[model samples]
Each structure stands twice: as C-alpha cells, then as structure tokens.
Target: MHHTRLFDSYICLDPSMWWDNQALLKETKRALETRRFHGTSLYLGIANTADEGMDVTRVLTDTTTATLHMRSALQLQRYFEHNQQNGLKYRGKYYQDDSHMSVPFIAEYEALRFLFGAERK
Candidate 1:
C-alpha cells in the first residue's frame, strides 16, 4: 500500500508476477512518461509476499518530493504488476475480486499513517 498527503488518497494492489510482464511494464513506463496525469502527481510501489509472486502498489502524491518518491515506487510497482499471474505462471497466487485485496484498506491506512503520518489535510 502507498499513501500520499498531496492527494489524500491511498492505494493497495495484489503482489503478483504480472508486474514483470513486458507488456504491462511498457504501458506503465509510457504512463509515467506523460509526467502529469489529471493534475495529480503519481507514485507507485510493489510489495512482495511469500504467497504471491509480485504485486504493484501505487501511491499518487502531488507534491514535488512525494512525486519523486512516487516515481521510484512506480518503477517497483511496474516490475511486479506486469510479471506475475496465478496458477502455472505465478504459483501459489492469491486472488481478490473487489477493490480491496486480501489486505484491508483500514490496515493499509494504518500502515500508511505510520509510514507517512496520521494527520490528514
């Protein structure tokens, strides 16, 4: 999960090998190249679990410093999001149909709060 005070938004994603896929990685690279998206600065991250292969976690921070961090996170996020898949491809994958994955938003929020801060603007 990733959090940013600039946009006041948090995002969580499954850590699957999809991140390593060449196609998705390329698309993500293209997206980042645009530099600006809908007036909000974007950041991405990837978290690895023993079960899932790799997953992309994205955080959008509009501020300059946050944006820079987001860029690095984006690189990591793309690495996993495009490469992993369930079953034969990824192995021992976890799947969630809803926006919230196996990980809860509140839990992720708390983590972000710890990582970023508790205050909300």
Candidate 2:
C-alpha cells in the first residue's frame, strides 16, 4: 500500500509513519511536492506520542525525545493537509489517546470510513 498505486485508497499507521530522522516522511513529502497524482488517495492515522498536554504546534518545535515520533507524524500530517496541489486526495487523524502499539485497529476502521466517503467524525 505504501509503494504501489494499484489501489486508490491506502492507510498508514505508526511507526511506519516515521523512520530515523524522518527519512520516509521526507521522501513522501518530496514525492507529493514534485509529482502530480490523479485518482489516488492516502489516509494517515497518526498515534499521539506527544507528551501530555502538548499540542501539535508545540510538539513540532520541541527538541526533546518525547515529542520526536509525534512531531514527525504531525509534520507529515501538516504536509498532507496544506499541499494538495498534486491532486492526491488525503486524510489524517491524530489519536490523542492511542499509542503506536494500539493505533492500527481503530485506524483501519477510520480508514475504511474515509475510503467509503463517510463523515470524518
């Protein structure tokens, strides 16, 4: 799902959402920035690894280890949000109470909803 365009809809769950120093995130951003895709869709379900009470703005600027994973996720999410000029339809969700270990199940459920054109809420 991550590499192929065979399917129109795809789901991403952490820690696949990130790699050391956010290599995958950067690569994905570059692809989205450079290439134009049509009839393709992406869904990212990011686990909330941020420290308690830390919001996305704060996490992205935090240099501590605690926010590293989540900061990357938020960065990717922010990228997917603002950069839609490439015609890649996308959606992202931050599970505030879910950890990386437990996010997949619910994320898949939400992904199904997105793929089926249901309400985000």
Candidate 3:
C-alpha cells in the first residue's frame, strides 16, 4: 500500500523527477531490499486505489513477504488481477455491485480478518 503511493508519486506522475533523484531512489530501494522481519510481514492492497502501481515482481523476488490484494470488478482502473497473475497472492472479492467508495469499508474489514484470523488477541 505504501509502496503503491510512493510509486505513483515518485515514478508514475513524474519519472524524470524520480530519475533525477537517483540517490533518493537508491536509498529507498536499498532500505526496501534489506528489510527483515522476525515474525510475518503481510501486505494489503485495495483496488480503485494506488495498489495497481505496485511492483509485484520486485516485491515477490526481493523478499519472502506475503500479500493479499482485493479489488472490485466494477472499478475500471483496478488492475490487481494482472499483478496477481504475475505472482502476487490475491483474494478475490469482486465488488461488482458496489461503487468505488463503498469497497474500502468491506475490503478493509476483510483484510484485517485475513491478516489476523489466527491470532488469540
């Protein structure tokens, strides 16, 4: 989720701007590449949002993190399926009947449940 937003702001919106800041990009990439988690790390991405901009290939190959992406079929810009096909774990929750604004309420709840269903807390 954070990655997607950063990608959109730093890459998609202005690639030249991002390229000009090579040092920043290198630092960020290094940080992302070296991150280690003791327990489990989970990512949750939502459709009609910044989720589509995420680099799934880099994420899957660079780290052994697990991600659960959800989206609505009704949202024309949603591209979670394509990224999922490229190797990201996807939990299909096609909110075909729901509008973009309504998806977050349901999707966020589903994300929390998916992430912590096994927890005693």
- Give the candidate number with the greatest lDDT: 2
Across residues 49-105, which tens digit of lDDT does each residue of candidate 1 receive? Answer: 222322333233333342333334355454434533211111111222223244445
lDDT score of residue 95 within candidate 3: 41
Show model 1 residue runs off by greater than 4 Å.
1-10, 15-20, 41-45, 50-74, 78-107, 110-121
How far residue 49's Cα lies from its native spot in candidate 3, in Å, is: 5.2
Question: 1-121 in candidate 3: lDDT tens per residue?
Answer: 2353222111011111123334444453344444432233333333332244444343334322222121111121133333332333334354433334766676566656555564355
Could you tell me the lDDT of residue 51 within candidate 3? 41
lDDT of each: 0.35, 0.81, 0.35
lDDT of 2 by residue, 1-121 (tens): 2455778777788645455677888888888788876788888998877777888789888998778888888888888887899898898899988988899989998888887888656
Q: What is the C-alpha RMSD, rounded to one decimal, of candidate 3?
A: 13.1
Error of 1 at 4 (Å): 17
**Any idea what lDDT model 1 has?**
0.35
In candidate 2 the C-alpha lDDT for residue 91 amounts to 85
> Poorest 10 consecutive residues of model 2 by lDDT?
13-22
RMSD of each: 15.0, 2.3, 13.1
